[model samples]
Target: MDVSAETLIKLYVTMQRIRLFEERVADLVSKGEITTPCHLYTGQEAVATGICASLRNDDYVFSTHRSHGHYIAKGGDLRKLMAEIYCKSTGCSKGRGGSMHITSAEKGLPGSSAIVAGTIPIAVGAALRLSAVGGDGVSVAFFGDGAVCEGAFYEALNFASLKKLPVIFVCENNLFSTHMPVEDSLANPIIYKIAEAFKLPSCRIDGNDVLKVYKTGQAAIERARKRKGPSFIECMTYRWRGHVGPNYDVDKGIRTQKELDRWMAKDPIKALEKMLIAKRFLTNGEASKIVTGIEREIDGAVAFAKKSPYPPSDEMEIIRYLFR
Candidate 1:
């Protein structure tokens, strides 16, 4: 498969967008301006950006509590995203869902759940619809390694594989499940191997490497769209922030500053920028401008969110939004 200069640059831009956006979100959370509990996606930008790079607009993506990257990478509106985080009426989910629960049906991000592995079955159901309705679209489930412990994860995999449903199970294994390390919780530390039991194609790769993720994801997406069967990918990545907030977990004694620095050294945005500059696909100056543009875009989104109205407070208006 051939990779173009444009595609490579686009990958870099998307990673930068996620990284910058998440950083700003962390800052906002620190200031207490955004009241929602945010699970920032900092070091793991490449996993979401690369996987989503080759996806079609109609293909669905279900995400986890750390969902900003996936939602943005899937072409969600930044303004709506920021608004939701700000809990404004104009936000996606109508400001009710906040950071963990965001959705844009038109953009293929049907929804995300704060509960670990909550959306896995929902993604399978979407794939079931496509399989039954004869659509080419495939559904993708993005969850952390924590989900692997949940029975719903296994059930979703089995049902999808059995029915040959068009779905991709993307396990964004960021080394730790909340504060617990993967090795501490899982008997078999190798996550992708579990897919073999269900007879699905699977692999584990360096999730920090955008090109590898992009190529592998494209292959799986292609296979699923062809109606062959489901595929699984276990992405080994790191989270730079705390499990629930902007702080690195070092202060909590769960991890160390040195360990965090080592991961930061392998920062995905910096890695991609190095490659792009080496290939003459981009320059430091060009990259700075790209980051500036993204910063401006994010600034606009923040401004929009701050100015937007909060969800209506009237009892009847609140009742209108409630479901049966």
Candidate 2:
């Protein structure tokens, strides 16, 4: 399917916003302004942007710890996202969910969880509900390669396939789970094979290319809307920063300088910016203006979160029930 220039540029902006948003949050954490553990999604923007691009406003999305891109891609408000990271009352979770648990039910983002593979079953459950109600909407579960080893992911996949539910399982195989590399963790690195065993339609693609990501995701989403069995997409991407922080070199033992430089050359934000210029949809001046504008918006979000008060401790009891 041909994506219009306007639509492509919007996706680029969303990806850039996600990258900058996470960067700013990391900076804030470094400066002690935000005291939360943040899993940055610096280089994996295309996977979320591409998948979310294919989804409707009513479709559901479940995310994992590395969810800033997923949340932003699915139309979560940046101001609220920043507020949640800052633990302010204006946050999407009312200052309790922190960086890992951002949620926007109105936008079909039920939430991201800290537990690995936890959202897989949730996405399956949502898909079952949508199928039962005969809704056109689909559900997407965004998880990492490590999550596949979990029993919940397998069970959810089996259920989704058996019921022919409208769900998409996006496995972002960044090749690492926390500090461990994929080679050390899984004997069979080919995740698509696992999907094949389940007889689910699946494909693996270069996650660095936003257009490729979009095309594959679009096809899968179209199939899901037609009530086809679940689709699994394994995106081969890289993370520019460490697993949980801004320091790119903090975990040098697992990631070498060569690998980092190689992935840096394929940065999603830069790739999209170059595409926009080559297509003449965005001039150099326009691109600069867009970056400046996004920075300003992020700055405003930080200020809003900083100025907003945290929920009263007495209200904590009321908030606890919402999680249940």
Computed on alpha carbons, the lDDT of every model, listed in order, comes to: 0.93, 0.90
Q: Per-candidate TM vs. native?
A: 0.98, 0.96
Per-residue lDDT over 116-188 for candidate 1, one digit per residue giving the tens place of the 0 to 100 score = 8999999999999999988789999999999999999999999999999999999999989999999998889
How would you encode candidate 2's per-residue C-alpha lDDT over 1-324 as one tens digit per residue? 678999888988888889889889889888988887899999999999999997887999999999889989998899999999888889998887998999998898989999999999999999999988986889999999999888998899998898899999999999899988888888788997898788899889999899999999988988999997799999999988888877886356877888899999989889888988998988999888888999999999999999999877877766786798
TM-score: model 1 vs. ground truth: 0.98
Clashes of each: 0, 0
Segments in model 1 whose C-alpha atoms lie over 4 Å from true places: none
Q: Candidate 2, which ten residues in sequence have the lowest lDDT sum? A: 245-254
